[model samples]
Target: MTVKSKKYHISGERLEELQQIAEENMFMHASQLNDWRGKLNIFVKGEGVWVEDAKGKKYLDSLGGLWYKAAGYGRKEIADAVYNQMTQIESSPSGSATISQIELAGKIANLYPEKSSRSFFVSGGAEAVETAVKMAKKFSILNGKPGAYKVLSRRYSYHGGTAMAVSLGGAKTADPMGPTMPGAIHVTNWNSYRLPYSGDPVDVAIKCANEFEEVIKHQGPDTVAAIIAEPVSAAFGIQIPPQEYWQRLREIADKYDVLLIADEVITGFGRLGEYFGPMNWGVQPDITTVAKALTSGYAPLGAAIATKKVADAFTGGPEETFTHLITFGGHPSACAAALANLEIFEKEDLVGNSKKMGNYLFEKLLELKKYDIVGDVRGGLGLLAAVEFVADKKEKVAFPASAKLAQKLPKFLFDRNIVTFRAGDIISICPPLSITKNEIDYLVDAIEDSIIHLKKDLNT
Candidate 1:
């Protein structure tokens, strides 16, 4: 809690030099085709829950550095851990495992729902998801159903950017990329805010869940490998499902002999106050994909933690060795950083803090309902949250795409010196689990100011 971001400012000449590099050398991701390269806000340093831009201006990092940073920033322990690991051994081949990888795998397994689960490391979340889907298909093959390679995913949920991950997640990011991966079936995703049908909340939830069973039946369960989804969808408004929903999915998966995968990349490592997000509802998935907080952004790392049942499928015969491989799947330095980051979590009891603060945050968010632009505020899990904007709250109508309501609101918040990102019509508010109430207040206040200004802009 005492950690503070160090002041950082580049000289005018240095700043201009960096701007030139941005305009030419650096190709940004999901950006305006290098149109505004020099206009980028270059963040130079970070510590605790704050980040400093090149101009020496510090802002509270409200999105937890892309929903990781469970232990926050500028931890010397993490840096030292990585340094020591690199000096000892920097990398490992996919076929082989390093001491760090072996140790880290055990530590990761202990945190999973089934403590005896096995971990298969990857570079990050996208790869983790890609790996999970493949694991399910492989399991299907083990069950003598090589034809069962199809995966079922919720329409609005986000998995990652790889072909398989994109295929599993039908979020907006997958739209412009053209066709989804073959055999990926997108199904109905439920949102409590805007029900697709009118009925009792519990009954309606069951109806939505039944839609998946229907998909499995229609697609032929024999041809289906797995049903995949984020325990709580992040990019699509933090869509939280009811207990009944997960229960139904589990039951259907069991009845149909289909594997269940929980894409826990954004919700893992105590993001939802629970060690694993799905634990909130007592749903133990066959495979859990994770990343982001695995190394808390200090090092790129991810893993598919498979339950003993799923892992045992690959343990037979010389040919059954789970043939999937990533060249740099379990880098030693990354494993070391992940181990250290997790140590910080235990030392600080960040998970307990998340539960306490998450409750307080949701209670406070109710106040945003007073504003016309605030249509829905959704989050019950730890730090993950979203505020969906609407032009007509009563009717739950969204601001037109032409208005770019989601885009401009974050810009206004930038002016107020807060850092966050918008996912379509909603703005994410996932700060570090280490965040204090005062920091949350600062973020919410900036959001309020941004909303007020945005309303004015729309009216004008």
Candidate 2:
């Protein structure tokens, strides 16, 4: 699994210029750009599962450009669609309707559950989450439950980065951003790898579901607007709950007369072997938020889809407008790109490929458990998976936070011309759906090599 590095050159002056611009103006997200400074590797191009840095070094992008890129990279069809749409209509007012937007909405609505036939466009996943939250609150009020404003989310769930989305997120990512939006309640997450209770998986799931019911009861069910959750909690280490878990959650939400919002930003648009995660789990959420793979990372676009009943709530007089709106909610070019991306998905049967390739990748990843440092390999049914490292496999003891394996492992893989993501001690491998069997082998080999190297370096 050796990575062949190619020698390429970029003008030193051009590199310095880019560095100067970044240092002077660019405020990076979730990054210490200042520390990176001039040493940062700038990717200039991408094709399929690979991206090339300015230095012409190619790296296999296992994370699929932050868990997007379902159609892989460098798709001329998507680009041409965007270009054609831009030429016809560069921009339209938020309130104004466009053909591309309407068509995209129809396509997405048809893919969703039968009840979910309405779509509200947004720029990205965070915006989609924000839109879903707003719709939930509005729907509650419209339905005569004005007190239903609280949203229940699972602990360690990652929604988005916007203030409202961050508040809805159960992770500690927004701790430093000051107090979260009021009424954002947190409950236990379903991470079997680090289960709080030692018992049968079903029993633990029931207990977790009971916790949700308890929270709703405590909060007063009438005051709860929605229970938002990711079908497969990707940010919390790809925690795939049992099928019973989702069924129970659906029942609980129904019992409390609360809307269920599935934040499918990661698992939507064929990432999880199905059209959507809810379909995969056989639970139909009242509202589903989608982004990322919607346009396959070729453009920024997201959608907040609602059941017909929910959408009908806002269809009254002129004054009954859904007040929540973004200036670029349904940019025509983005919608065109999304439509073209979906076309590729249909033509190439990428969803089917995701299911097949995902199973193969999962099987290969399990081989990593042979290593002493590889604590767990969790994933299947989709093109998403993670490898959790441990200091003691027998006791399931995790490495100290100071070890910084999460930060170090990605770098080690990057140096070897392989790109992946690390969350805490877990390394997430989510390649494009188009990735082949040989690429999966390459990815797993790189991961194993990096872990072995780190073990010796840390003398673990």
Candidate 3:
């Protein structure tokens, strides 16, 4: 089979359009544009984990387009699948029936810990979370707890940007958008290293679970429908909860009749070395929402996977139906892309690679404790980890957000041909699972250099 080799040089007319588009569209992106010093650098292409700007500068792409792009840029397999699917059937509403939608849902549902869990498709993480929130509320209302609409989530935890998702999020940046959905409550997250509570990690996890009960009691469990959390908090520092956290939380949720929703947008599809994040913690959520790695960002796709019990609540002999629908949910092209992407994951054993390489990255980062600015490193197997910077290690005091160290670190590494994500003061690394040990070493070395330069710049 002979494949056509297409040149990617930009024509004069297209170049002008690109420039015009940037200028005319500049105001619409005013917020991000302002942060970019009045000009946006347009990117032309990507391959593997690298992206090239219009100016021809290549970046290692650690941020991975806000932690999407799992299989990395230009995976011909995914691209081919998407192209073929689009040519055949671009899209249609999954309106109560669609063949591709059903098959894709089955594929996703099997990925869950529960064999009988049902799946609902969505466009992205925020939508998946939003759907879960709606499901939880509607289920509670229909299940004899009309007052159970409140949700409890951890502080600094980020579920998404949608109204209800934002409400469930604990991240400071996520809030202040406006008055959020009412009844969403905030609580402390699992950060044992930062909050030195004496005892076993499992014990600490149990304590955290107890805190949920306390909060529910204070607010009246009758009013709380669900408690949502990232199994391993991703955006607000990859804080891995103690071993017993999920188990205890599960028990508590069962006891209180409150649903547990695991927001696995970041931890799903091998980011955590497991097929799913909740499995790592040995607990299953009543509902699990995931995005990011779903189609490896090849196509916009996300999922709301629910236990059989939850699905049964809405699936009563066709008399009662769940009043929810997304126009592009389970879009044929996206579903085909997702199906292809999962095949790649299976063939490559990406999950296994993530576990092996994640351990390597974690152990390597622990060696950076010699640097005073390196307050702590947190994360779990494969592709997910964060290196937090601080002014005083003993005090665990983070650098002022204004210092821009987190933002600056990535740029410094970009200069040296490496890239990373900076979430506030923590330099986050969720490299594509395809990353090799050599690449991991390269990434770490660049990070180390950035730390040294930052320290010098700060001190001077």
Candidate 4:
């Protein structure tokens, strides 16, 4: 298979019309709108693991459209489901229950652990986080410990962009708005590669878990409502914690009586080869938030699943309502799309494929370490992996922030007809779960060639 050169271009009235739209009203996330207003590649279509720009140049969607789209693009099954649902009923208020919403919630409950059997729907990941946070606090209050309102989150973790979600997130980019929500505490992240202690992986994991315990102790466990974390830190460079890390954290949370909230927005729906991230680590969180692949990016939908114990707390009297709602929390069409997406996952054995392809991709990525610029290649649990670059691999020295290597690498790969994501110096490659071995090889080869070209261009 011959890879096409990046020579496609657009012009005339169509280009002008797009430029006007892009420049006039569109404000992209995490971007300098002024600088990127007109200087952006407009994607017109997507199919399988590839996407085409307005210029008709096709590129492999290695990041799965921001780590969603696990079932791949152009899924007509999901489209048809959404269409049929819209024909019947487009949406319903939170006060009312829709059939699609009820079915999706039940399906999600049955899919995850029995403990997390009740769910609250929301529009997206951020809203899910917001909902989870509020539930944790309210649960504490209802349980008679109103002081338990602080949330412990790890540094470099990203929950979402809402006020509460942003506060829970520890990423620098997630904090551009300056002040965060109150009572959001930060703790050490389980980045074994950059661990302060040098020892066995299990020992390092123990040490990391100890840090979390210490924070709870110092903050006074009685005052802490919950501990929110990603099973495999995705937005923060795919930081896969040691096997012992999650179990240890779960034990600590249980001991401290703190609710464990697993933000599986990126790790749920078989992205990690398991139904949920906590399941992948063999630890069930009290509350699990899911989005992204829940509907395989076919539609906007997210959910916060709570254990029966937690949900039961808000029940009893007729006046005992959760007291929160989102207008489109349970859109009938979105729920229908999600149901169809999960059906495809089961029929195609995409979860099993994620595990198999993830292993293959991990081994292929390890080959890149032979390059002087490649520092680390981590990720094997499932189809989520990353390639971290360094100016000095021996010392693990990162390039200066001003260099903006992370921002530049994506464009470089894009020019070579490969689409991946970058977080600072770490490049992430998470293709659709349905990707074939041939497609994986093409992605890895393109990444290698791009790194070689980048090193030469930088004279490194």
Measured by lDDT, the strongest candidate is: 2
Residue-level lDDT tens digits of model 2 in 1-460: 3234445445478778987898888876677775467776688778899988776778999899999989999999999999999998888764578799989998997777763589999999999999999899989988888999999998889999889888877776555687778999988889878876889998898788778899999989889999999999988888888888888999999998999999999999888899998788688889999999999988899989999988989999764579887888768899999999999999999999999999999999999898898888998878889899899999999999889876788788987789765545888878899999998988888888887889888887
Alpha-carbon lDDT of model 2: 0.87
Look at candidate 1 and give me any clashing residue pairs: none
> Each candidate: what lDDT?
0.85, 0.87, 0.80, 0.85
- Candidate 4 lDDT over residue span 1-460, tens digit each: 2334344445568788888887888887777776567667787777899887766778899989988989999999999999999998787654677798889988998888773589899989999999998999889888877799899898888998788888888877553776777789888787756775789878987888788789889989878999999999977788888778989989998998888999999999888888887777689899999999999898999999999988988897754579888888867899999999999999999999999999999999999999998999998989999999898998999888876786778778877789765545888878999999999999999888888878887788
Winner by TM-score between candidate 4 and candidate 1: 1
Candidate 4 TM-score versus the reference: 0.95
**Model 1, span 121-189: residue lDDT tens:** 999999999899989998998888879989999887888777777777777655567776788888778
**Candidate 2 — which pairs collide?**
none
Clashing pairs in 3: 156-170, 358-382
lDDT comparison, 1 vs 4, better candidate: 4
Query: Each candidate's TM vs. the true structure?
Result: 0.95, 0.95, 0.91, 0.95
Q: List all candidate RMSDs to the true structure.
A: 2.4, 2.2, 3.6, 2.6
**Model 2 ranges with Cα > 4 A deviation:** 1-9
> Which 10 successive residues of model 4 have the least lDDT summed?
1-10
Q: What is candidate 1's CA lDDT for residue 343?
A: 94
